[model samples]
Target: MSANARTVHPLGERLGKVLPPLMVLGVVVAVWWAVVVKTESAIFPTPWQVVTGAMELVEDGTLWEHIRASLFRVGAGFGLAVLVGIPLGLWMGWVGAAYRTFNPIFQMLRPISPIAWIPVAILWFGVGEVSPIFLIFISSVFPLIVQTTSGVHTIDRRYLRAAANFGVPRSVLFRQVVIPAVLPEIIVGMRIGIGVAWLVVVAAEMIALRSGLGYLIMDSRNAGNRYDLVIAAMIIIGTIGLMLDGITRLLEKLKTVRWRYVR
Candidate 1:
């Protein structure tokens, strides 16, 4: 195709991509507005009402405070999960016997819901940030552990053999060959773990905490009827989650785009 045709094609493609998401968002808002109208109750505020409530919260500094609290929990939980999960996963992946011996425990824990562990988490860590952090950790650990091990196990044998033939030390081989080869997997695990971390953070906040958006929602419910604030908080939580996922996806693309042509 000619350069002019290629340029036109890109414009069409970009519009095609942009229009769908915009239309979907529009449809969702319309449905939400319709439901609120049909209900015709202040207890079920419309989308515009929620947006105005969100702005009011923003002006009063309440939104920022809640956002900070939620973000702190996410960071704490995600940091802990990454620090512990990645190393353990790498170890399990690189060693066969270790994988066999320890995987069963992980399997048992993996099926346990974060919400189910709320009572235990509170008992063990108390009703503080630690309890919520523990919940986040539980939610996030399995994906990293499973994915990292899978990635490590899937490394091409020829890569290992080539490294060994060069008399590369075991430590060096892991650092140079194995880590790089499995990085795409590690990033994938991080993506999944980050998602789970976000999911658990909201639940933890609602159950164990006095601040954050989750608490704001519960607090609104208790204050005689602020469904507007409740809906606003939910929107904020969803928006932040979407932003987090997008960031991780962009990071993954940046890390792995160069490997696209590899067979």
Candidate 2:
């Protein structure tokens, strides 16, 4: 293709990728506006009202504060889960004895809702910031552990045999073979964990803490029945969650991690 054709091709592809989502978003908003107007809903917010409410918070400088608080909690909690969960999962997956001993326990704990722990969190951590952080950790950690363990279990046995035939040290084999092989799944786990962390933090903020988007939402409701602010907060939460998942996805592009994805 000519240089001009090449440039136009990519530009056209970019627009093609972008326009469909924009078009759908437009349709959704048009319907939302129509329903609010047709029903003469006083409590439900129109899209414009939600935008205005968000702008009000923006002007007051509270929007960024709440966003930052929520992001920080998710970062801390998800970071801790990564630090603890991945290694534990690796160990459990590599060692049959460890898996046998702990798998049942985690399986039981994983089924319980993180929200169900709010009362216990308040009792133990006492309505402090730590309560929400703990909840985020709880909500986020299990998926990482499960996914990482599965990743290890699914490693090709031929790779292990080849390493053994080469007299590769166990540590070297783990570093060069096992870790790289599992990275895609680790990224997947991180994506899931971070999403859960974000959800837990919001719910935790709603009940136990007094800052973040969740608190902004609750405060807006209790103070003035501001459904617009509530909707805006919900939108912000979803947008941030999508952004976080996208960031985790970018890790799959790493040279070491790309094989599983590209193939």
What do the candidate models score in CA lDDT, each in turn? 0.86, 0.92
Error (Å) of candidate 2 at residue 65 is 1.0
TM-score of each: 0.92, 0.96
TM-score of 2: 0.96
Clashes of 1: 0
List, in order, the clash count of every candidate structure: 0, 0
Candidate 1 has an lDDT of 0.86
- Report the lDDT tens digits of candidate 2 across residue range 40-101: 99899999999999999999999999999988888888889999999999999989999999
Lowest lDDT block of 10, candidate 2: 2-11
Q: After superposition, how far is residue 165 of candidate 1 from its true place, in Å?
A: 2.8
Instruction: Single out the weakest 10-residue window by summed lDDT for candidate 1.
Output: 254-263
Model 1 TM-score, all chains together = 0.92
